[model samples]
Target: MALVNDRFSKWATGFSGCDGGDIGSPHSKSIWYCGIEWGGGHPDDEHELINKVLSNDVEFPSEGYTSDDSPPGWLYNLAYRFNWQAMKLLTAVSGDSITSYKVFAEKVKPFTKGEKGYFKMNLYPLAFVNTSHDLWKNGFAKATGLDTKKDYHDWIKANRFPIMKTWMDTYSPKLIICVGKSYLPEFSLAFFGEELTFESEIIDDRELSWAVNKNGTIMVVLPFLGNRNGLNKNVSIQKFGDRIRELLTTL
Candidate 1:
């Protein structure tokens, strides 16, 4: 069965915070992982506070209130989860360059409790969308105990992969930057076949980057960035943007 966009929508709805009542029906073109739900608030409840945060209109403390009435620790938890997912993608795309997990964390933290919450929300969704195929073929469900019925892989393959693939095939971007190392091998195997060359240069005990190109063609596996050394700390957002531009130039 071919994947379609709607099926991916359904799969995304299966997550802990994706209940439809508060979020309403997601649009086919709406940012799938951009984090802005229709009704606002956490996935479970609709609160004015949540709406404000989602809209990027949140203020540190409401007008007269001394402290926020928002759920205690929920904001932090949400931020942490979002960062984790982004890290996953970053590692997959960048490999050893991801040494500064803290860098990624700090970069994403400011967006957590603001109108850009959707940005934080979509990090995982985008990662899932980009890597869903590799994950399923590689037995990620079995290893992680993620229910095939509800997880992104099952849902995307059933619904969205075709659309995404069409987009990628058309664009054929040269560098696919993933944020976490954990996702690299699986992604490589799924997209480029199992026999492809993987030349690894280890950065530390926990992470390394393997460089490979598809059939001596345009596509190349750049280094996977991980959270390790102060790389994240040292690299500025402008520098990251420059890196992305540099990668695009190769394509």
Candidate 2:
């Protein structure tokens, strides 16, 4: 079985709305969530932007007309092309509420201004970590309760941890890779605490990969694919592909 979440349907519907010229459609009701813009009805241009930003050389329609106006099908095609099975799984789980997915899709929609085309760029691939309110309060800190803070960590602890664990247990991927440098410190502190040990070579400022376990499952952190600055100097389009390939080898 594949892992999935509610964001998939939300993305599909949101993109469908954009294609149909409904910019302000409500995709998800959650506070930390908002639908993607897709440059407001530039469905055709959005397709091209996806190819360029992802650095893939493929021709996709820049018009509202797809092989079919089936937004879900289009989303699936994009996911497969990008090797984002995680996205597919999330959509599958969405069942009827595809909030996250729709928001992401709409955000990446393309637009052209005068002679220049604009493409939305994402700075990181989604990272899944194991956590919960109990884990944070008990394992991490009592002060880190859900009510006081509601960032990504809190969101994971409150909403995503249980589902994330279930998915990890079921899918059992050999390697879990995180996509950012900033996430490394928090991830390390979150799971390892003061007992964390790093491989000497990876401790340098360059790209680092290490094993972190929670309830016996292991995770690895790599440079963010979307972070063009900071410690991810070498993390270009080519590097992103290489890193993913390396991760697959480990898997």
Which predicted model would earn the best lDDT?
A: 1
Ten consecutive residues with minimal summed lDDT in candidate 1?
Answer: 19-28
lDDT of 1 by residue, 109-179 (tens): 32233322222221123223223334333233332334443464455443333433333243333343333
Instruction: Name the TM-score of candidate 1.
Output: 0.34
Collision count of model 1: 33
> What is candidate 2's lDDT per residue for 127-166, written digit by digit as tens?
1132122322221122212232234244443333343344
- How high is the lDDT of residue 222 in model 1? 28
After TM-score superposition, what is the CA distance of residue 214 in candidate 2 from its true location, in Å?
9.1
For model 1, the superposed segments whose C-alpha errors exceed 4 Å read 1-151, 157-162, 189-197, 204-206, 211-251
User: How far is 209's C-alpha from truth in model 2 (Å)?
Assistant: 2.3
